[model samples]
Target chain A: MESIGIVNYWIVIALMMIALYIVISANNLIKKIIGLNIFQSSVFILYISIGKVGGGTAPILLKEPAVYSNPLPHVLILTAIVVGVATTALGLALIVRIRSAFGTIDDQDVQQDIERN
Target chain B: MIAIELVVNFTLLGFLLVTALYISQTNRLFRAVMLFGIYSLLTASLFVALDAVDVAFTEAAVGTCIATILMLSALSLTGSRKEVRFRRKNATFAVCVSIALGVALAIGIMDMPQFADPNAPANLHVAPYYLQDSYSEIGIPNVVTSVLASYRGYDTLGEVVVIFTAGIGVIALLTARTSKPKED
Candidate 1:
């Protein structure tokens, strides 16, 4: 049981690592953005997982009924998801502007242009 | 319970470590920025597992999301990371110091109350009251909203101020006349 739990933990962590690696190692701008999205989703999963209590039901309060998972985390994650989408929009907007300005999105190419100037 | 928690925590931590390595070794600037965002997000997950909802939310929103976008914008202007050329320089020293500090913190955390132990200080403190009475106290179903809007109202207001200030700064930066040579 203990090992199973540990494996689950590692699996989440491993996904995070894979996403991070893609973000860092990829030369493509789009790939980097994808990695960012993956990373954020991982955190979202973490928040939702922590809030779950064993044998707990959904967090809605019901009269004469019992057992509810904590609603707080769900609420928090909802807000966070909204924020994430907004940020992604802004980020893409910036990327568009960047492409227009530099004519190339690759980091090295832009830097070379700067150096030449 | 402890075993499960430990596995979860370790998994999250392990992912973070690998991501850090990925960032350090990557040769693309845009990719590095994205990785930094990913790193922030993974850390946020760890916070959630620790039952720190507020922290996890902030990390997910500001750190992973907004921060990543800003970084990408900066990357567009700056270009990719320089190709790895020579031997390691100062990296070993930096890594050793950081690792030492991290280990120290982990040791301290080991002494902390077990995750969700009913008798733990955090579980028994004002947190439970907030969890139990948030609905009645504020007439809100979402306990986090009640806590943020009411219990920790002052802090939330401060955050709003910070955001307001940031907006003002952006406006000024964008609207300034005779913007000389700041590339893009």
Candidate 2:
């Protein structure tokens, strides 16, 4: 039962690893940004998973007494999700700048252009 | 009852894993971006299953909606429709590093309190207070809003500033002249 309970964590970890691999290995700037978004989303899942309670409902008040999942993580992640999008937008903006400057977005191509200059 | 919940959780998580793998392996930038949107939708669904409705709502809006739109716009601006198909010579090194870190993290996870355990330290520290008192103190039906808007107002303010700064940064970066330098 304990192991079953942590299955989400295992999956989150796997997702994180896959995203990390993409970020590290992918040469395309846009693909790397996509990988970073995946990594961020997986981390959000891990936090929400930690906040889950077996018999809990959403963290909304009710007339009748009820268990609620931890709301703190939800609040934190609410901020994080918005911030993640902002970061993504900024990253993509930089990618656009890079594309214009170098005429290519591939990591190796950009590097070779730098060396040739 | 628990059986069904577990099944749903497992199935959703399995799909998430597979989608992440697919995103990692695909070389088509557009395909990867589209699949990433699917990934975010699945993640939001998982958040719903975890009883974080507010988080799920935000994830759906920001992740699936805003992020996808931004990525697609970026794709159009950058005009790189396809990724270079060269084999990654360091792929083996990257895999080894990911696996090593993943195993270490898994070992660390073994010591974590069982999921959904009521007495977990994370559940104990200050969460109970917000959960129990936010309704009475803030007069809001949603504990998350009370905590976010009332208890953690400053943090949200800070987040807003960060977002504002990011917006400025994006405007500055995207609007700057990219014309080639003229020889003196």
Candidate 3:
């Protein structure tokens, strides 16, 4: 089934693009950040999904002959998740500071005000 | 040859379109944040469908949990709700970017190997040994762990540095005074 084949990957990519559009198009800073998080997440899924081999077993490397997933993607994804969390935390904290310093979170307003100053 | 894959792909595509519409049309900030969280969750599910347990775990943890929390925190920093308007100039910019991305995607799709074909070069190289002998070679039952910590140790190091730098930057940004909170 062609559906079983490349379609899943395309679906994943579409989700990613939607998230990216939200991020780029959203005027609200927080929403934009939210969009970005979704975007990154979909990418993560894309990478993880690509690592899948049909009927593959886990990457634990059994002594007996067996099918196993590529472990590298799994490990890499673990690191990516950690990095994603760190990035989100940092971004949120920055938003907090931005609110306190600027008294607003709308990007255009921030820009206009800066121009005014 | 491609029936089941087609159905699953279409199903996932439907979800994607619905989510895009929701995010684009939503007026409420809180709702948008919540929808975005749902979006992450679905993406995580996609990872699972892809058979990437480690990546799925991370997506669940980072994308659904941590990222959602951060977005909520950001919401707190901003006003509760307001009129969300998409400016025309911004729309134009988005369209241009979309067109550019479309072209790039077309190029990328052209260059890609046929979907999930076992004979694809990616599946033939390096992967066979890693799958078959990684545990024996590295003495770690978790072949993923072996590959990450042994074969690709330097990659891990780079990740560590990136995270540490981000942490430091966040600390610097959040610091109100010269004082610091001790890390546990």
Candidate 4:
């Protein structure tokens, strides 16, 4: 039961590590960006999980008394999600520029090109 | 009810783990991108289950809709359908480092508050105040909206600036000339 309670965190940690491995090991720039998005989403999940309270509903008010989950983390993650998409857009744009400038998106290929030049 | 919730949580998390694993292994960039959309959808559903309706909605919209579109557009622009397959000399090293860090973090998690403990410090600090007073002070039924738009207006402003900067940066990077002028 105790393990079940924190299973989400464990799974999130695994996801994070997988993403980290992808980002570090993958030579493709675009794959690295995908890895980065996964990493960011995992962090978002962690924050939302932290804010969850057992038996609590969404943080909306009602005339009747009700328990609401913590709203602060939700608010923080809302901004973060938007910022995350913005970052993705920026990253993809940079990739497009790199593809055009270097004629290849593979990290090693670009490195070889530089070395040859 | 608790048992049902536990089952659902476990199933969703299991699916998430599988998707992450597939995304890490696939070399086809297009397939990877599509799978990432599925991954984001699953995450949004998990957010809904976690009582984060607003965050869930945003994740569905931005993560699934906007981010996917942006990635697809970038893919078409780059014109690369497959990742270049090469012998990864450092793959073993990276796996070891990730496993080591993950173990360290998991050990750290044992000291943290138990999940869903209402008395957890995160729940105690400023959250209760926002949850209780947002309605009375801001006249909004949604505590998250009131807190985001009213109480933490400055933070929202900063977010807007960050987004604006990102937009400008994307435009600048995408529109810049990549080739030098040819001499006649």
Give the DockQ (2 decimals) of all models. 0.11, 0.70, 0.48, 0.66
Model 4 segments more than 4 A misplaced: A1-3, B180-184
Place model 1 in a CAPRI quality band. Answer: incorrect
Candidate 1 local lDDT, residue B175: 44
Where model 1 places Cα greater than 4 Å from the true spot, the runs are: A1-117, B1-14, B37-63, B79-87, B170-184
lDDT of 3 by residue, B34-97 (tens): 8877776776666555556666666777777777777776676555567777777776676667
CA lDDT, every prediction? 0.57, 0.88, 0.68, 0.88
Q: What ranking emerges by DockQ with the best candidate at the front? A: 2, 4, 3, 1
- TM-score, model 4 to reference: 0.95
> How would you encode candidate 4's per-residue C-alpha lDDT over B1-184 as one tens digit per residue?
6566567767887898899899888888898899999999999998888889999999999999999999999989999986657456758877988899799989988877777778889999999898878888999999999999999999999999999999999999988977942222
Model 2 pairs whose backbones collide = none
Writing each residue's lDDT as its tens digit, candidate 1 over B137-166 gives 898765666866787777656655655555
Instruction: Highest DockQ: give the candidate number.
Output: 2
- Model 2 is docked with a DockQ of 0.70
Instruction: In angstroms, give how far residue A22 of model 4 lies from its true place.
Output: 1.0
Can you give the TM-score per candidate against the true fold? 0.56, 0.96, 0.85, 0.95
Positional deviation of residue B149's Cα in model 4 after best superposition, in angstroms: 0.3
Report the CAPRI category for model 4.
medium
Cα deviation at A94, candidate 1, in Å, is 16
State each candidate's clash count: 7, 0, 10, 0
> Across residues A22-88, which tens digit of lDDT does each residue of candidate 3 receive?
7777777777777776666666655665666655656665658776655556777778878877887
Superposed Cα deviation of residue B165, candidate 1 (Å):
2.0
